[model samples]
Target: MCSHYDPVLNAQKLKQHFGVDDLPPGLKPSLWPTYVGPFLRKHEHADVGDEAVPFKELMVGSFGLIPHWAKDTKIARQTYNARSETVHEKPAFRDSWRLNRHCIIPAEAIFEPDWRSGKGVATRIVRTDGKPMGIAGIWTGWKNPANGEILRSFSMLTVNADDHSFMRNFHKPDDEKRMVVILHEDEYDGWLNSTAEDARHYLRQYPADGMRVAVHD
Candidate 1:
């Protein structure tokens, strides 16, 4: 249930922290790349939540999910995050996992772990370098049965943490599971256009110590 994450840096902050050349002009300014909040498409004519019309490159999606079917407007309250392992198999997520899976979940940091003797001690892991961490994810569309409206949303992908990784010790010996899949710089394109096989191929785990962690400041 990795329902919460943060983009310590986003389009607005991209130019300030990262080299302007790294990103095409499209991914900046429109959306913050999260589950909720913000009018990402600054363009006047763009549709608010439909996927049929492609949005400007400058404004990324406010959410990565394009819901296949949404019974109520409130389904979003619980669908912010979907587990990578199960997503490919679930009815709600399978379509997005195979075809509609195009997204880059940018973040400055993520929360993972270290294990105490019996309990889990949480830590905030930030990138070792100043550059932002862009985790892998999937998106889909939901059509509201009641109103006949469409909404796009997303979920972050997660892989198990290894024994020596930062959150490795969090679980019992048989189960040191972790959230937050870390993508390699070269692996970006593969993930954004990932096919079902690609889902099993490219999404690699981030290094255990690849990020910095601290108590909330």
Candidate 2:
């Protein structure tokens, strides 16, 4: 599960990357499950057109997913990641997927536990080209019944990485290997708008050769 990442870009950079006109002010430089960060979702009322695709303004949402049917926020910690094979069938994520509530979580770098040296060590992974990655995700809105406050949250999608040359080096030796679904820049729009059948094509491991990793003390 990817629980942390470097959200190093500011609102201006995010707006430019997603081609949006507005974003929330004062975004943080890093984010964890409970932190608020920017995500791009399709506009709710975009009209059918051939000239241009309508994009919704950038939205600030929490990283952990809190399904609308969830009774409380405690479930979010366990819902941070949804496996690709089950995302369409899981109770917590199926509704969002069915409704086409998809999103993109941009990250400058992501942290993982690298066990290559025979001991678990923290490692930061980033693109070899030094550009941010658009991780595929799903989002939904939840309301606190007590205060009637609505909160939107998301979960990163992951796929099996037991055979991945690079990603297989992380996590515990005995644990099941997994990696987040990092989408190519060109697939951003398609991921946010593609039907479930077509979206399956986007859920695969990014090439290991395109990434670099640094072990931390």
Candidate 3:
């Protein structure tokens, strides 16, 4: 699971990189479960009446996904990650995937556990060239029936990485290795607007050579 990540860019840089006029302010430098961070998603026509339709915008939303049927937010703890293979069928993510509620989650680095030391060690993974990653994500808006408040949240999609040269090093030894789906610079917009079947083509593993890691005690 990608429990932690860092979005190191400021408001101005995000706007320039994502090619948008307005940027949200709550781009948390470091994000963990329940933390709010910047994400890019195309707004739905009904969600933004009278506003430009199909326009992508930056919004600050919570990290974990809260399914529409969820009775409370506690489900987010486990929904932060949705496996790519089953995302379209998973109970928590299926609705969003079917509705084409895709999002691009920007991050400078992701935290993982390096188990090479015969014990788990915290590790940070980043691009060797130091570019921010546009990770593929799916989002949903759950309205609280009690108070009528809408909660928007998202989950990063992960693919099997047991055979990956670099990504296989993270996670527990007994657990299946996995890595987030890092979208290429040009693929960001396409992912946000693509249909569920079309988006499947973008769920491949990133080249391991482009990534480097740092271990922490």
Clash tally, candidates in order: 16, 0, 0
Worst 10 residues of 2 by lDDT: 48-57
lDDT for model 3: 0.85
Candidate 2 lands at a TM-score of: 0.91
Which regions of candidate 1 are displaced past 4 Å?
8-66, 112-122, 145-147, 162-164, 171-176, 215-217
Superposed on all Cα atoms, the candidates' RMSDs to the truth, in angstroms, are 6.9, 2.4, 2.9
lDDT of 1 by residue, 20-76 (tens): 212433333223234452212112333477675433222234343545664554555
lDDT of candidate 2 at residue 24, scale 0 to 100: 60
Model 2: per-residue Cα lDDT at residue 36: 83
lDDT tens per residue, model 3, 79-132: 888999999898899999999999988887899989988888878898887777
Number of the candidate with higher lDDT, 1 or 3:
3
Which one wins by lDDT: 2 or 3? 3
Q: Model 2: per-residue lDDT, tens digit, 135-191? A: 999999999988999988999999999999999999999999999999998898889
lDDT values for all models? 0.55, 0.83, 0.85
